[model samples]
Target chain A: MVQPEQIKQWIEAGLDGARVTVVGDGHHFEAVIVSPAFDDKSMVQQHQLVYQVLGEKMKEEIHALSMRTLTPEQAAQQGE
Target chain B: MSVQDRIKEQIVSEKIMLYMKGTPQFPQCGFSGKTVQILQACGARFGAVDVLADPEIRQGIKDYSNWPTIPQLYINGEFIGGCDIITELYQKGELQKMVMAAQG
Candidate 1:
């Protein structure tokens, strides 16, 4: 079983200054990833970057990952 | 025709196309089901290809899009994204606007 923290660690290692929250039951996962790298990127590009972090885990271990990716500005705007 | 050529033709022919796990009326995957719902919610009449039924596409699409997932969406031959991106767009009411723009 994959721990949420492990997923968080992987993402953190891949992205700089990323605020990541992941919750899952080994098979399925949901993540809200806030990162500076996501700025000026398209939604697909943002997700692609996060996907790059997980790599083979996404194919072999995790069944699904529903993610909400945002930049710091977008995250702040979300609070408004 | 080569698979790449065929894939290109399909996208070129359909203004709105979805490559999903199953048919819109009876989706196989939850992500595919949700994506179908969102597309319908946008009032978009789209063409759907059930990737599960076609092994080549099931594997080929990942290579084609460089994305390792099903339920990929295209509008006006533009690669929009998969379920997550679509869900975010839908929540922001941007999906409907995109659909309308594609239809125009």
Candidate 2:
């Protein structure tokens, strides 16, 4: 089982500027990630970016991961 | 036919296609169940494949869409996100618009 902090760290390491909040019970996780990289991307593209960052962990460690990807601007607007 | 070919045919043939863990009436996964509810709420007439019932499709779908999860949605042969994206889109009323456009 992967820790939430590990997930957070991986995302932060992968994206240039990212703020990720992860909550989970080992297997299933939910993430709210704000990143400059997400700007101008569609929702599917935004998610694919995150998925690419996680790499093989997405297939092996994480049983389920639901994400809310946002641009820094959108995150600020939403007060996230 | 290859699995990719089969998936291509499935997605293109259905205006709104859902590859889920189980049927709408009996969703095996919570995410799948929630997705079904969202689609029903939108009054979307979608075709669904219970991946749990078909091992080939269960695995083929992930590769087909390059997405690592179940409960994936496709509209007009395009890959939409999974449960999270679907819920967000439905909440923002974008999903309804897409469904309307597809049905028209």
Candidate 3:
């Protein structure tokens, strides 16, 4: 099973200055990610990038995910 | 006829319904909060049931929709999906159109 710490590690590996939170009920998770890497990406692309970080864990361990990807500016604007 | 049955009936009868983690007034999770924001932005006047308050509703929703997630949205008595799907649809302007059509 992919734990929250694993998600944090993945975020730290791919996103140097990202703020990521992974909340889940063991099997399913909701990830809120704010990264400078999202500055020039569409929402789909942003989600794809985060998915890439999870890689095989998404397919093998995690059953479902509710993800919200945002640039730092967008996150700041939403105050989220 | 039980609580789950009533919840299912309510979902089917309501034009726009969200089976979410918390009420719109007090969202318990970030994803549910964002889902509410997206619905509000789409100008949707919908019914929201807090799944977190009732364990039966939370588990029953998955069985009802065959979707193992909270923050599920239903429009016109159809299961649209969970928070991610809702946000994605909202961003593409599809959700607004669907809601408008349903309201008419």
Candidate 4:
């Protein structure tokens, strides 16, 4: 149901300049996200932001998600 | 006495262990990949065994931890949790402290 492309679309819609990598077996996903919107938020809040982007897709299709959210600075520090 | 027991014993015998989908060098699944990244970022020495490579260990781990998931993390003979919990812990900076304390 919640295909990878839909995730990409949702992220692109929610954030102006967000980099998202979606990896999983369809039902479960591991997302590596770098967004300027995550600059001052706590990790939980960052994850919540991403989830909000997904909207109702989380309940309808996505079963599980393992997220690695970082600000652009963090991502840059990680050499990504 | 059983496969589960053997798996438990293995986990208990190892100080820092990860029962993942594939070896640390070649993680077969995305969850396992993220687990490895978090562990690496902690800068702790760890051992990772590929459950997918062995059917016995794969099923045994589920029974050993009573957790039906790959990328299970164990520290000092205790089951920490799966990828989500690990990521959460890592984000909170608790994982680094835990690994450091364990190493010490």
Q: List native contact recovery per candidate, as a fraction of 1.
A: 0.69, 0.77, 0.23, 0.15
lDDT of 3 by residue, A1-80 (tens): 77876776787688758898888877777788889998998655566677677666665777777778888898999998
lDDT of 1 by residue, B10-99 (tens): 876889999999899999999999999999989998999999888987877777887888889988888899999999899989999999
lDDT tens digits, residue span A1-80, model 1:
78888888899999999999998888788899999999999989898898888889888877888888999999999871
Query: What tens digits encode model 4's per-residue C-alpha lDDT throughout A19-38?
Result: 98887778877778899999
lDDT pick, better of 1 and 2: 2
Return the candidate ranking by DockQ, descending.
2, 1, 3, 4
For candidate 1 chain B, the 10 contiguous residues with the lowest summed lDDT are B57-66
Per-residue lDDT value at B67 in model 2: 83
Ranking by TM-score: 2, 1, 3, 4
Return the top candidate by TM-score. Answer: 2
Best by lDDT: 2
| Residue B93 shift from truth in candidate 2, angstroms | 0.8
Candidates 1 and 2 compared: the better one by DockQ is 2
Q: For candidate 4, lDDT tens digit of each residue in B24-102? A: 8889888899889999999978988888778988878866654555778899988787787788898889999999998
User: In candidate 2 chain A, what residue range of length 10 has the lowest lDDT sum?
Assistant: A58-67
Candidate ranking (lDDT, best to worst): 2, 1, 4, 3
lDDT of 2 by residue, A1-80 (tens): 79999999999999989999999999889999999999999998899899989989988998999899999999889999
